[model samples]
Target: MPKPNPANLFHDLPDKLAAELVNILVETPSIRIERIVSTGQCSDAGFWYDQEESEWVIVLKGRAQLCFADGTPPKTLCPGDHVTIPAHQKHRIDWTSASEPTVWLAVFFSA
Candidate 1:
């Protein structure tokens, strides 16, 4: 067996921001892990994410707001906050802190 690869989650952050940067840290048949860096990014109006896989996401740095299509109050996520979104749930990023890059760790898995 080979030695397991080691990495720091906060390493290699992007300096310029044209779009959200997504890096896949791990992928297998049943699960995928990604690191997302967002600097003042949000979903377009009337748009939502309808994913086939369930997702568990955590904010590693900065802050964000997640809104659902059901009219519930948007969930505010600060650093160290996390939420699990069920498959097919209509959700979108409403806002993110612009002064600093918001770092997120997202894990997607089969339901």
Candidate 2:
């Protein structure tokens, strides 16, 4: 089989409250692929992901605000923004716009 091209795999998914399309590696073990995530607006829910796993996120379109659960001011994320979540850091999606789709790329890998 030919190698997968990251550019060719990119896509925008439908907009829904819990809509998330895994265009790539959806069922692969030890890794995950999430595209076009509409994080929405809520500050009370967050995940205490396993510390042995690290996440790399990129904002492909629209905007959002991400804040670690340590009383830090939210950081604005726009198109082309990228951030890496450490293995042990607990974070949350502080806010995201409903006016426009906030497309994001997330790759999770074990440390």
**Which ranges of candidate 2 are over 4 A from the true structure?**
1-12, 15-27, 39-52, 71-73
Q: After superposition, how far is residue 80 of candidate 2 from its true place, in Å?
A: 0.2
Q: How many backbone clashes does candidate 1 have?
A: 0
- Per-residue alpha-carbon lDDT of candidate 2 for residues 20-97, written as tens digits (9 for 90 to 100): 444554637788876755736444565534356788999987788887866666678999999888887777776787
1-111: candidate 1 lDDT, tens digit per residue: 965444877776765588999999999999999999999999999899999999999999989999998777799999999999999888999998898889999999998
The candidate that achieves the highest TM-score relative to the unseen native structure: 1
Worst 10 residues of 2 by lDDT: 8-17
RMSD of each: 4.2, 5.2
- Candidate 2 TM-score to native: 0.68
Taking all chains together, each candidate's TM-score versus the true structure is 0.90, 0.68
The lDDT for every candidate, in the order shown, is 0.92, 0.70
Name the TM-score of candidate 1.
Answer: 0.90
